[model samples]
Structures are given as C-alpha cells and as structure tokens.
Target: MSTIIHASAAPKFPLPFSHAVRAGDLVYVAGQVGVDPQTLEPIGGIKEQTEQCIRNIEVILQEAGLTLDHIVKVTTHLARVEDQPEYNEVYAQMIKQPYPARITVFSGLGPYLIEMEVLAYAPSIRGE
Candidate 1:
C-alpha cells in the first residue's frame, strides 16, 4: 500500500537515512544540508547554500516521482539570522507561484551556514 523512495543523487554524509519516505500520499524528506554529492564538502554562504539545499530537495522529489510543485511545506534552518534576506532571494529562485507553507528556524550545523528540511505531499488517486 506504500513505498519508500531513495534519491540516488543525494549527498552521502556517512549516515544511514533515506532522502525521503513515502507513506500513503505523503512524502517526508529528511533535513538536507548544502554539501556536494561527490565532494562531500559544505557549499558556500547562505545564498549559495540555500541554492544547493533546494537542488538536493529537487533530486529527492524526482526520485520519489514528485516535483517542487508537489511540496506542501518546507522547513529551513539557518546558522545566522542575517542570512534571512539572502536565503529568501535564493529560495524564491527555485520555487514558483503559490508557494508552500514554510518555516525557517536557526540551527548551527557543523561547519555549515544553513540546512533545510522539506515536507512534500503527493496527490492520492485512490482517495479521489
């Protein structure tokens, strides 16, 4: 009745976790950081890190047979409050109109500027 989708292009941070898990019609993505998939190093500042984080989310969505448009909400984590403006600019670039509900909190990641976790929803063909 349900399945789990693992993102192949996801960054391997020496941890045991799937990118997203699909149960019923909802897909839950784990907290994603701005690290290169191959290099495994943290990306640039807030702006650049935000871009990379979104990209990683996109990859996970694709693997789960979804897209950014399917996401219902997003939770962002930042190391610095001053990065809010820059993070907004980068975030808006990837997501389109009728944006998903969002919440951004401040957390200090190891040697990182920002981290993000997204909650995405998929349509239920069975219910409707």
Candidate 2:
C-alpha cells in the first residue's frame, strides 16, 4: 500500500501535490524550491536556494520519520548551470559522505534558482 505524506513545516505547494508519497520501502519527495514555508517566496541566490531546498526536503522527510541519511537518490534542476559550484559546496556541507546518487541539469525554473527531489529508502519507518 502507498501513503501520501505532508510536512507542516515545509512550504505550502503552489500546485496540487503532496509533499511526498511512500510506496513500499521508498519515499519519493516532491520537487522542493527554495521558498520560505510561511511566505512561500523564493529565497536568495543559488547557494542559499540550494540550502533551503535541502532544508525543505528535510522537513518532508522528517514527516516520514526519515532523514537525509536515508536518501538514496536525488534529482535537481538549476536555472543556471553556472551556479553548480556554489550549489555543490552547500550540498556537500549538508549531505555528508556517501552522498546520495544525484543528477543535476539546467532548466527554466521560473523565479526559482533551484529545485530538488529526492528518493529515500525506509524499509522500517512509517508515516504518521
């Protein structure tokens, strides 16, 4: 069976979509932009945005009783490919060693500089 997940602390999605969905042993998180939860406004530049995006994902994962350590894969969209170096610096600081498999590409993200989605492995954890 699958379950939809929501995080009260995460930014409200402008569109209709759950924060994440748990299916079997995996939790697939929706794409997260660098927006403040209360304001739902995109944050600063790529580095700051990257940090917020991961923080947003962390909140969603927390709702599922999971953490960044549980993530097995990641897909990111960057409005500018040139922002990669700064983005990678912040990512490395937050995601620890044995980093999740990741792929990043340049894409038009409207007003946002970065957006990220993650897949986590959680064979034992359950959502409330």
Best by lDDT: 2
Q: Candidates' TM-scores?
A: 0.91, 0.94
Of candidate 1, the 10-residue stretch with the lowest lDDT total is 119-128
- Clash counts per candidate, in order, are 0, 0
Top candidate, metric TM-score:
2
Q: Give the Cα lDDT of each candidate.
A: 0.83, 0.91
Put down candidate 2 lDDT per residue, 78-106, tens digits, no spaces.
99989999999999999967788899999
Over the full model, what C-alpha lDDT does candidate 1 score relative to the true structure?
0.83
Looking at candidate 2, what is the lDDT of residue 88? 94
- Candidate 1 clash pair list: none
Q: How would you encode candidate 1's per-residue C-alpha lDDT over 1-128 as one tens digit per residue?
A: 65777787988777887778888889999888888877878887887788888898889989988888887888988898899999999888888867788998888777888888877778832113
Model 2, runs deviating above 4 Å: 124-128
Candidate 1 residue-wise lDDT at 112? 81
